[model samples]
Target: MNAELHTLTGAYALHALSDDEREEFERHLGDCEACTQEVRELTATAARLGLAVSVTPPPEMKAAALRRISTVRQEPPVAPAPARPVAARFRGRRMARFALAACMAVTAGSAGVAVWQHQSADDAQQQARAAQQQSEQLAGVLAAPDAKATTGQLAGGASGTLVVAHSKNQAVFVASSMPKPPSGKVYQLWFNDAGTMRSAGLMDPSQTTEAVLLSGPVDKASGMGITVEPSGGSPAPTSAPLALMNFATA
Candidate 1:
């Protein structure tokens, strides 16, 4: 039973086996780690094939393929030697067919995985470029000659400065000293736009001193404030701000 089950490994991995054959193979898999590993790798490869983009083949592609096949010389089958047993020859042929089918399936699946990986790499590169451009824009705002800076202190002994570039409508928050928040809590920054409060960003409490880019247009904001919130942060201040700094109007 074990020897026969071993022969079904390729079929089992490709999910081509009958229910009974699959059940028997699974039972054998428990005692065979090599077959288990092969099946896992094959299954993952097959999953990658599902993620591949599908495209309609050109109308002429089938005709072109037939034309190429027609021109190829066909190999004549060689007669088996009289001394070779008929059953052994037939078994050899069956095993060869199974191996060929498994190889073709694996090759197609690998190609699909390669295409998916390439697309993922391209998406990551595009995201990195976008982040680099945003950083450069923020750096320009900080370098502006008209940028003004002011300091503010928090009740929890945390202090930071608000450096605003009025012309650019941007600001950078540089923490001179900030204590780490208790577990499950984080410090969040907000901009007071007139009477409405808008989220600027979250501050990293792990760092003693760090500069954070306050995203969004700052021209309309009259002041900035910070408050303790849950780790992921909140849309609105959940508690009273630890500190607040008002910007001087020119």
Candidate 2:
């Protein structure tokens, strides 16, 4: 409920709490946001901790678990055996028990490995999906009929084909033949998404034609503009546009 208790909540969730302290924090967690965040962070930390220590619970559980396994295991029917065969049968049973224990250990180890692999896979998938969603969003804007509003020429510049695209979201400015930006000076791009104007990017002029991507949410793009700006980019155009391409979506 309060910061002190909230901090203890983290310890509680992670099993780092003393018995009484644990009870106190658990009782308080019903209403605390700070506690909730800490609990969430600690839960993640605990999951990692759990993998570090794989001690099985209690011996009583092992007995019950073994009994459950025996109930499920199919035992071969007993047969009247010669005296020599009786010893062999006992040995065979021992071997089977040892093999079962071996199998269980292997299974548990495999499951632990599988869980870590699954998490890593899920993380990679999440990143890939995010990238794909962004690219798709960009593609939809690029493929829109509105994009034909203006024609971008791919000229044989000193760098490569100077291909450029423009839209309301922003101008997709790129130049292949252009040379890289000077040591400190960078090429900047601009777009009039509506009446509002904004600088697009500060990039190496030489690599400009390589079609670098930009994230935008833009409007009423009347013209595409490029300028020389400092590294990274600027929010607004500080200098004259080096190149201008005018286009209309309507």
Candidate 3:
């Protein structure tokens, strides 16, 4: 594989490459298994990151946008030369109109970008807060006196451990060498309450091995199960369990 071409996987996944470069990379993908796998993973990651969680603009955002727009200086209209031919004067007028339209477009785009940046900042702050909360919950679960862990070797050379703390009503799944789900699919966790199964949470496709704090309380669940489900997960298990661990037997 061409080292330079291999490095374009990110750009190619985002469709940011030039036409010539895209064509060349497509050709390379046909013969390079590593590049093909990378492109698939990169494309999935980009799609996940591109999902927009709408955030309300701040109170002053509108005023700020207006202030930015007001800073744009418009060009004065040019007068056509009287001595020019009729066709030349007409063309000059059309050009002037086009230029004015372009300037207005640029001004609008600038304001839009400012608002977008503000919204993006808000989104990042919210994500950071959510992450901090999850970290604290994970720590609590880990510190529980009744916490118990079960480890098992899964198929495909993968292994995992399930840690549960009844006192905290929380459980965490730790995995190693877990295989990536198929395109448009994700690994989902389930809490087995008696004979019924309830959703725990969806795993991040970008991570194969990591500690995942299950979504809901697990005090009543007898065990935990993992299955391959469509992105965002399904209401019920759509396939056989990839792995299962009994909490009592841990």
Tens digit per residue, CA lDDT, model 1, 108-210:
3321122122234344444434433544555555566676667667665756667777888888776644778888899899998876779998876555555
lDDT of each: 0.62, 0.45, 0.65
Could you tell me every candidate's TM-score relative to the true structure?
Answer: 0.47, 0.38, 0.52
Candidate 2: lDDT over CA atoms?
0.45
| TM-score (C-alpha, index-matched) for candidate 3 | 0.52
Tell me the tens digit of each residue's lDDT in model 2 across 1-250: 2334533433343355457655555555544433343343333233323322324367699789888986796879877666654234334434444344334334322111111222343444444345334344434444444443343443235321122234445334334345566677777766656645665555543333333334454445566666667777777776776666765444
Give the range where candidate 2 is weakest over 10 consecutive residues by summed lDDT.
108-117
- Candidate 3 residue pairs that clash: none
Tell me how many residue pairs clash in candidate 1: 0
- Winner of 2 and 3 under TM-score: 3
Per-residue error (Å), model 2, residue 186: 2.4
RMSD of 1: 20.7
Query: How do the candidates rank by lDDT, highest first?
Result: 3, 1, 2
User: In model 1, what is the error at residue 94, expressed in angstroms?
Assistant: 64
**Model 3 ranges off by over 4 Å:** 1-119, 248-250
